[model samples]
Target: MSEQATTTPTDDEQRGASTLELFFDLVFVFTITQFTHAFGHEPTWKSAGTIALLFAVIWWMYSGYVWLTNEVAPSTPARRTVLVVGMFGFFTLALAVPDAVHGHGVVFGWAFLGVTLVHAVLFRVSGGDDASAAILRILPTNLAAAICMVIGGYAHGSATYLWWVGALLVIGVSPLLSTARGFVLRTKHFCERHALVLIIAIGESIIGVGTGLAEETMNLQFFVQVLLGLTVIYVMWWSFFGNDNEHGEAALDDLPMTDRTRTALIAYGYCFVPMLLGIVFAAAGLGMAIGQGERQASWAAATALSGGVALYLAGQALFRAALGLPRPWMRLLAAILAVLTTALGVYVAEWVQLAAIAVVVYGAIIVDDVIGLRAGERSSYLAG
Candidate 1:
């Protein structure tokens, strides 16, 4: 097969997410919101598990595009067209999220399959034989997953879920096949793209708060709840962005290609799933708590509220570990705090629970910042 040189910008060419890439991400903003809403509507163990499974599917699809864009320059007409169509496919997938378990599973499957095939074709066209061959090795795994998705779509109840699991299993293990030949990840663009996606996920949490409270009559308590929610979001943002962000960039920039690939795969690839999961969970909790207007939370709602924080903090810790950085002891502590607060949530008013969670997140950020500051103005990996 003849490989055409792609006009797509590589790390050597492009430094940050392009305008078209940003446009591509807009669809996912709605997709993440849909996931949060789905969980909010049915806050149960079963619902949570199903949504988590669906999110993995959704996240993997988007991440493939991110990797594609990172490798290719979007300057070519072909690449641009591919991106535009992929965006529509992603939007269609997002639309199918609410009813994915039952009625609309086929629609979800087709959209996902379209996006996956598009990514594979584009990667094949732009990459050399080695690259094409790597993609080829991985293609079967993706196709297998897509097929399972189709089967899952047609099936119902437990059978549908089993097929989706089959799909995820194929996707999860497939990456191992191509691990020996890592792909190019323009450090700056790669880091920025992932960061932007996380920010979008955080935005989803805020949107969740707004949607939840939109039904309530305007009052001081409503404003207070909104304020507290925003504070918690801010602190979460700070905890991730304040110190961790630079270290991640440094790791990507400084590490050798094989190490960089491994780090990217482990940290950004796998770790982000839980982080996104946590954000969605937190958003679901916020929506429930705010909508109820300071009512004492039901067991499900309280668990959603605190469980979300625990998951988020735990995801952060894993992200740090993946980068070969010092583990985020404070975040681990916060995760523990989250679980404890969740336990406390059962006894307290919903608002009190929200406030307490915010305090724990904020305290973690403060502690982490102090430790980083005390470590002093050390140079980043970029300096070398």
Candidate 2:
């Protein structure tokens, strides 16, 4: 590739995410909405497994684009066109999600293949030599995964599941098969891009509250549920955006290129799967709990609520560990407590269970702050 075709910004020229990138992320928010709505409508183990499978495949490529834009921004008209095409692919894929495991598998597979192709072509044409070489090394496996998706689309019956699982394995193992030493990590943009996606996904929880409220009569109970739901969402946001982003950025910036690349794959690429899944399940669960103050929560709804929060806290713990940050003992304890609330949901009123989860999460944050204060360390929760 010609040097001029490469869009990798120099270290001195590093920047945050661009407007086009933010717009691109808006397309992904639609996918998040689809997943949340689907799960909310049918909060079953089967549905949850299907959503997980789809998310694993979709998130892998979405994260790949984040890496792509970090190194090769769409500053040029040509690059912008390619990215917009990729956005269309994501939009189409979102449309297919509600029925992906059933009737829309073909459409989902084709949309995914298109997205994968766009990522490869854009990176090869616009990335720096090292990045170009890196994408080239992994291109065959990527294509193989995409082709598996296509074959999975054409599949039917129980056989379809096998094909899709095979596709996930192919892509999931791609990082192990290929090396990341050739790619660059633009730390600021990389961190900001991930933070933006996460915050947008978090918004789905608010949307869930709104969705539940839409069917209920406005009353004292309505106001109470709204407050409790917002509290849970707000606490979740604080848990991540508070200081984890800064810690993550600092950790990556401190590493050598090869180590940084591997950490990014593990931290951002792998750990984020559970974090995002937690948001989806939490949103679905919260939607089910809202306006049902006196009724006992169904098993699926209860598990979705408590288990979802536990998953998020656990994912956060893992994210911190991956970056070599101190262990999040308080959050880990909170995750355990969150899981224990499943019984509370099944027996007590849904509102009570919701309240317990909120207390556990917010209380953990407060305790974490107290521990930091006692140790004479700057509190991570208080720091910007």
* TM-score winner: 2
Model 2: residues with Cα > 4 Å off, grouped in runs = 1-13, 374-384
**Candidate 2 residue 106 C-alpha distance from true site, Å:** 0.4
Q: Write the per-residue lDDT of candidate 1 for residues 206-311, one digit (tens) a residue.
A: 8767866656888888888888878878877777777677788887788877677767877888888888888888888878777456578888878887788788
Which structure among the candidates has the greatest lDDT? 2
Clashing pairs in 2: none
User: How large an RMSD does model 1 have?
Assistant: 2.9
Give the Cα lDDT of each candidate: 0.80, 0.85
Model 1 ranges with Cα > 4 A deviation: 1-3, 6-14, 180-182, 291-294, 377-384
User: In candidate 2, what are the lDDT values of residues 114-197, reduced to their tens digit?
Assistant: 999999999988787888888998888888888888888889977888888888998898797667877888888998999999
If candidate 2 were superposed on the true structure by all CA atoms, what would the RMSD be?
1.9
Where does the lowest 10-residue lDDT sum fall in candidate 1? 1-10
Residue 68, candidate 2: C-alpha displacement in angstroms = 0.4
Error of 2 at 279 (Å): 0.1
